[model samples]
Target: MTADDTVNQPSIALNSEVSAKCNEVVEEYRAGTASKVDAILRLQSIIPRSDDTEDQFKSALQSYVGMLDSADQARASAAKRGEQHDRSSSKRPRSPPESDDEDISEKPAKRSIDESRLPWVIDELLHPIELPPSLRLTRESLQLWSSNPKQYKASLTNAARCPEFPDSEWSNIIESKPINLDIVFAGHYSTSFDNRRTEKLGELELTFGETKPSKRIESAGDWLIAWTKASEALQFAFPHRERELREYGSYVTQLFGAVHPSRHHRVLQYEKAIRRRVSARRDLSLTDFSRFADLHLLHIDSSGAVALDEDSRPQARPNRGGDSRKRPGKGVEACRRWNEGRCPVDAARCRYTHICSTCRSREHTAEQCTNRARAN
Candidate 1:
């Protein structure tokens, strides 16, 4: 044979031998004995004249076994993960019964302070001064708004309002009308009477059980003035409840008052302002379609053997410029967006409409199939 013929003959024999040996190793690996590497080495050693052919074949076989073992381990791990997921899913908290009666039965009784005695206590404390109608509240507001009605009433009376006087000037006042027991007990007030004078009056009243006629009535002019200003400021803050304003005001009173007495008024004011601003603004919610479209804005690099078309192309060759356009390996080529034997953009416009090439039918390429795509 000529030199070229002899070279060609050896190449052909070598290719055939390699193919057969690869097949043998694969079969052995599948059988779980004599490992892929051993089988391949045994095949190569049969041709002793070939230098390190056994070693080369063993290396390749090892690589193949590694890939197969990795895949098998992944599958087993996935199955184990799925089993754990199922167990966790079954362990979720069961929802409680939904009916109002069921909810009521399940809940422990609330510790409610006696609201029946609230008004009377309030009246006694604020004696001789008629409570403003603003101090009165509906049953729902009363129960829901304050844990302690007496304290709630006092805070409401002290809330910031127009014409706020500093705490300095305050005193007792003569009766403008019959004293409201509610205002006396639960409300804040000041009296201008001296302790000695008050004691003398008390002693006289108690001893005689009657008042002498023509007794001089001492005036609490400064005290009355201070009380008037303070009361006005307090009352303005706690305005008479209209239905719409009641809920917001009551909520403010309950939460802020209970948690922060000194800052309660300021907090309520700020929170109300914020709510107003929010209400004035528009609301928007993005749908799934819009969200998906937004992802396309991200940058992507596509350097591969496959072109925009699914057809495989020859590996990229470097240009004269010396910049290499690397051809994607088999593993890398697995991650591209396609559908129904076409790209995403093309599939959307195609007459057949997009379908999973791998799962739905045999005609389309598996690479372009939606159903065959594995989630990362």
Candidate 2:
């Protein structure tokens, strides 16, 4: 055959091969063997090399996919309306009606199904495209996917394909809470100070010296700076101290309130600093650092036992007896330990009253004191 004839013959053979694949797909659909989406994907995989034929195949596949999508929507709508349709109503059977018993299945089974399918679905959705090296699947991302599967599936799937994706991070994501680090750190530090002060007081008394006065925390900003500095110092002196602080911080934050933006930023900075320091000594993997940096602090109470102002600074605890209408004699006596600046007891568990710092008396704070001038 001539050169022109040879070229034309291969074009004809390619068209025939494409036609055969299309026919096979049609047969699969007619036999109810493959789903519409599956059939379309199959056709996509076998598109001819010719641009014209490829364009035609894509156009036809697009139209077919659209029809499949519409049918899915109709099926979902019917299900929501409680309409019982025959399984054989469509060329491809709809998934069996989920039995109520499905909900009653063991928690482990349900969790297993989720854990297995989530990564696979994510992989399929985000194939050939991956997430940035810095980002990983966080608890927030998992929650978002779990809450709105249809809405966030695309994004989650993309994130799942990230090279830095932590497959084992799912467990952590499931268990982690959006903890308020500042409040947690505050409680931890408060308790630590109390313990240390008691020890120091005992030492001073034995030496016939007076106990040192407590350092008053003027504002939330000041408190945060002090706590951050202390944490840095502790972590510097004892390498394991960082992990302990994180554990305590996570526990406190989860128990008390949501993470404040300022506190969250500071914690991230602290973690980054630690990572930098560690990397200097030994090569740090992005995976390890991501795991270390994964502070699951999202979706918590806006306000908790510890309150914060709009500026994300911790608000001073309200005075226990600020109301002018209350009788002074009926007021509870303040805890002497608390007044001396460190209450060893848990704030909530403590039986004694929390006194206002501005006034020594439990009757009122300086803000509400009628005898403010006299006291001054």
Candidate 3:
């Protein structure tokens, strides 16, 4: 492989020995017997034990996962607070009570940059990509980059790579977050070369990319930089950004693919894919997003449905089977008609899965999901 080729390592499938261990780790995770990092470390290891396995796992996951349990607990607490506010508000009757339209109006409007513009992928949660990233791979530039100690060392770190290449670094190089080497080598930079920064940033564009890039300072990298700000990769510092980036990346990943994820179906399929790439591995690319114009991740199924074969003929089963040991991101969404007791189709012939609508697990229905019980 060429020196620059190291930045794009292909996914290495598990060998028989590693596969056996993978099964154990995945099983432990499904049974809740293993912490996410613990299960991750088990699969990541080529050997059964290592002095630094856990440390390395944490360091890698820290790139985007944040403090796993702590973040979950914080979200759980916020959910509780929202519930309490709702309950107390319901108990307080207004003089004549608000009309339905007024009530709906009081509900927060969709987050947007303005009244006229379509909802952007960037906001407080997401910054905007200003320039297209380095393009051309010019011979002179390549020679200079190869010789520079800083760039040579950067190839080993995640911050120098795309997607997970930190937004923080655009503002401050010293604060670039640490990411796993596996993720560092993942982005298909060649794919995104065609995606240009159409929007103008004037003088500010230079701050995000090389001066005069794209003959106008703005380019694809700058645009991606904007999208990256709202990305899930930034969730550790901006907790509210998580859902927005997930929805955005998940959309891009499944955009042109068959068996698109069910956004309105309330299944965990897309969410889990986002979690696997961004949450589990700190990978920012969503499933070959750059294949068309965005991100891609290893083992991340943009199809958001079960593959019965290589052609990805989607199965009719309920649940994309999202939590399988063989693939990290696959799941069948619950059949909306069946969930509503309106589908006349048999379970064996339904278009969607018969799994739990909330968690997407086959173990229980949405009514029986733990979150529902807890809320009750």
| Model 3 C-alpha lDDT per residue in residues 75-162, reported as the tens digit of each score | 6898999998999887966476457787656766654323111112111111222321222222223345444535533543444333
lDDT by residue (tens digit), candidate 1, 1-376? 3323423456557445544554555556556666545654554443223243445434444444454465457568989999988998989777877778987577676666533223233222222234334333322344443456445445644656434332211111111111221122212332322222222452263222211111111122322332244344433433443432434344433544454333232333333333333223222111112332222222111222212222243443565678543323332222123331223232212223233334543223454345566641
Q: Candidate 2 lDDT, tens digit per residue, 106-200?
A: 33532233331132232222222344332223323444556655444334325543322121222222233222223334443342232222234
Give the Å error, residue 129, model 3: 18
User: What's the C-alpha lDDT at position 269 in model 1?
Assistant: 30
Worst 10 residues of 1 by lDDT: 210-219
Which structure is stronger by TM-score: 1 or 3? 3
Global fold similarity of model 2 (TM-score):
0.24
Candidate 3: stretches off by over 4 Å:
1-11, 14-31, 36-59, 67-105, 109-376
Which pairs in model 2 have colliding backbones?
A: 178-297, 178-298
